[model samples]
Target: MLENKVALVTGAGRGIGREMALMMAAHGAKVVVNDPGVSLEGKDETDGPANEVVRDIKAAGGDAVADYGSVSDSASAKAMVTRAMDTFGKIDVVVNNAGILRDVIFHKMTDEDWDSVIKVHLYGSYYVSRAAAEHFRKQESGTFVHMTSTSGLVGNPGQANYSAAKMGIIGLSKSLALDMAKFNVRSNCISPFAWSRMIGSIPNTPDQEERLKSLRMLTPDKIAPVAVFLASDDSKEVNGQIFAVRGNEVFLMSQPRPLRSVHRSEGWTPETLRDHMLPTLKPSFIPLHMSRDVFSWTPV
Candidate 1:
């Protein structure tokens, strides 16, 4: 579906990024596998996952190249994009799949942890997307697939840093979708619950793993096709949306709820607040899908 298109994927050395790069290549895109060969905590290593994916792509008769640039660094991100242009002359898709997890409670989360997670996930997407947007604008057509997380949507304990970064991508994707609409550049975010090194360490028994495997709910490959669709012409009209992909289930998430006024007329008194505000302030819940009557107080 992506014949003659050039695609760049960060964190493509292994896991979902690797699968996404391979899937795009299999669909006829000339892929650029960008991975810093890092661990889950952003520590650098000498692994060749990026090179290996490129080799796999070439072995499958698809075009691919390897890039060991860190997506968090502006210069490295620029270089990665430059490599795609240098290798294929034009960039048609960019997958910001590079991310890191620094799990910690709000009290225990240090400044370093917060900054590092933000740098890798939030700023990484920003740097890479900004660099690619220039090229996509020139072409007047491009796709940006950002790898977000369910943790961002449903706040997970002990993952404040990670959740904040992931949620920021949602906002960034939405704004970019609107800003780049005129240029035919589509931006979308995907929250994938896949079995990767990041999730492997999350206290799971062999039986649990077997059960999940049987259910087919946590494989990285299962998430790749959705990403491929987003990167292909199939999703040309889909923009500013956040999707959750896990096994056979694909969830179209809702936007953040706008603040609502409970009682504006007779406010400010403690007694009035106790009687009126407390009762009137209904829990604002956002529905998963868009509907004509969004403000209805009915249960789904």
Candidate 2:
């Protein structure tokens, strides 16, 4: 599906990113596998992960190159795109899959904890996308597949930083789709429910044991097909959208839309809002629930 295309997949060292890179290559995409080998908390960088994935792709008769650059830095992020163009002559697709976890309760979260996660997930996504925009505009075609999360789409505790970043990515993807549609540039997001090093870092309790067991069944490879589909011409009609991929289930997630509303034609004060508007809107209020609470069923 991706013959003669060039794709840049960040965090392609392992897990979901690695799966997407390999799968894209198998489908005839020349892949730029970008990974700095950072730990779950975004430290301890190494080049081994990126190099290994490149070797694996080459061994399978697929073309690929390693890029050991931090996506959080503007120059480094741009370098990844530059590498793709320099090596393959052009970049047709970009997958913003690089991320790190600094899981902490909102009350106890430190500046560094919040900033690090935001830097890697949100800023990293923006920097890379902006760099590629110029080329995509000139070429008149490109695709972006961003890795979002249910934690952001629904809700999750002890992940203020991560959740905020992921939600920001969704907004970024939507705006990109709207702003660049004239140039035939497309952007979409994937909320993946998979077990990886990032998932393993989440705070676990006795209550989550069964849920964790179910999560273990959702391997990262299951999410790759969605990425491949979004990157190829098959998804040309898909943009500014979000899809959630579970074990064997693929869900088209809904975006923000008004469920209910109450208005006072006379423009009443706070008293009217508290008595009339509250009652009218209360019936349509969304429940305060975590991501797991909303997806309570076992993985299919």
Give Cα-based local distance difference scores for all models: 0.85, 0.95
Per-residue lDDT of model 2, residues 179-211, tens digit only: 999999999999999999999989899989989
lDDT of 1 at 51: 89
What would the TM-scores of all predictions be? 0.89, 0.99
In the range 146-256, model 1's lDDT, one tens digit per residue, is 988767787656777888898899989998999999999999999886778887654444655554454344679988999999999988889999988767778898886
Clashes of 1: 0
Any runs in candidate 2 off by more than 4 Å, and if so which? Answer: none
Model 2, residue 76: displacement in angstroms?
A: 0.3
**Would you list the clashing residue pairs of candidate 2?**
none
Instruction: List the lowest-lDDT window of 10 residues for candidate 1.
Output: 290-299
